[model samples]
Target: MIENVPEKAPEPITGPSVVVLDKQVPTVSDVQQEEARRQTKMDAAVAFAREKSDRVRKLAASQQSPFQGNSTGKVIIPNTKVGQGYDLFAPVDKKKMKVLFDWLKLDPDAFINILRLQYHKNPHHFRSGRIYFLDHVFSRIWRDKYPEFKSSEPDHNGCKKKAPWRGVDDIYAPVNFKNTHWIAIWILIPKKHIVIWDSIAKHISDEELAEVMEPDQWIIPYLLVECAGSGELCVQYTLKPFTYMRVTAGVSQCRAGDCGVFTLMYIECHALGMSFSPAFSSRNVKAIREKMAVDIFQEAPESHDKENNDNDENVTTYEQ
Candidate 1:
């Protein structure tokens, strides 16, 4: 109060103040806001990826086969879920069906498994991969008129069918291929004819197909012919000269895995007594997948059938 002091000078600024982060950094609400932002970005990315994937798949499918689309020229995606049906489509189930598709390399046990399932699923169903089993000239005689020739699982394990050729009229053989291929030998019992209907005419030889499916057997004295020191004639078994005709038209599988779809459709058409047409090759693999899933869901036993929904997580891996 007596004397005025010099005004205090302001302290000179140095640098920016350092912020210390403690355990209490970022409050709960702040973290939640950041997470929400991240989730929004993730959702956008997922949508973009899904769109691109769908487009590519569509293009690939289009090139493989022709399919009927909506009026806007959009391929109609079938309704997977019906009253009760469908799980994984065909392409997704490829691994499960790989062995079945590869008739040439399928092991005995694997082949029997399919037969067992087919046997149980629908006894009268005309459609099955088993029909191709008859490609062999000598298959231990599924139901040979004589019990001596009749064959069964080792030690006679499986049940006998009503007839040797139960639930089959055509042999649908889908060949693993560079592009695609399906060949069938239509067995007309009444006509006593075995006609090869290959999309790629003569692409597969009769002997080769027959050899691939024939049951394994030790060389028996009876089968061995005494021909110039001995051997069976004409493919190990004496086959009656059945009329052989090759169907070389309209039936074609143009891409990988197309054999499965085309063959399945062929069987369906044959079951319904429809003439073979170009539509089969045109029914793209995607639709085949959807249709197959639906068929499996509807036809498979309830115990085997998971919920008829498109939950990829619930896919049932077929045992090898």
Candidate 2:
């Protein structure tokens, strides 16, 4: 007699089932992938910004000096190996070059005058800035000799050469005389010096001619005067001429050992006789009056005025 008894219901699982954790847990690959994507975006942005900055810098440089381009054509400075026949040397240092450029920037008129004086003193040695210097000297000489003669020609030879005065007609004519503004002087320096066929009629003062023969204290003194009147003159201890060997050594040797000989290319353009308006003069007068009032109220008025005037002159001269 078997009584039908329901098998006791399987005991309900008491609590949560035991979870088996894998030793090698799944990595957060999706999160990592998202982070990588973000990092890539950041890098791209940085690269784009850098590229934009470079472009802006280049554009600014171009705008500042429009005439500065390789379009004027190329002038090569040939390489001279160690065993070259002549001993090559550099005539100027980097600092000196800066000084020279600075002098050129301020009072270009003074630079022109100095160059003319130098050419008159010594025409044979062939100075570095020969052609341009000659041009300035010729213009001045022509003006002095023929005050009434108003032709487009610039002749220092005193009407000797058959070459008619092709003044404004010449491509390299002075800026203000014509409505033209662009002016450039190109020089081709080969391995050896090129002989200028045109005879430079010797027109120099007795003192200058004597100094040329004797390049000692006398000549240097005259040069110093010219330099002083022009602007602040800074001369480096070392005076090196631009040369091929120097350029080669600069490229090949240790940077410190590299020579600082720059193959110079220069262009100067003037905005057609742009003069300051009377408004500027009024503004200057107002400034002067204000300054005077302040000085008059000072304890040592006379001393203050003197010092202020000196300072003002210095500032004005520098601005010019």
lDDT of each: 0.42, 0.30
Query: Clash pairs of candidate 2?
Result: 90-240, 91-239, 91-240, 91-241, 92-240, 152-166, 152-167, 153-165, 153-166, 153-167
lDDT of 1 by residue, 1-320 (tens): 59978999999889899877897678999999999999999999999997765663333344344454342323443323246455454355666655433532221222223333564666566454434332111232321322433342322212221222223334433333223344444554334455555544455576765542232112111122211122433233222334556666556644543444555455455644467766556445565555555444455423122242322322331110
RMSD of each: 23.6, 27.4
Q: Name the candidate that leads on lDDT.
A: 1
- Alpha carbon lDDT of residue 13, candidate 1? 80
Cα error, residue 3 of model 2, in Å, equals 13
**Candidate 2 C-alpha lDDT tens digits along 111-143:** 233333434566453423334332322333333
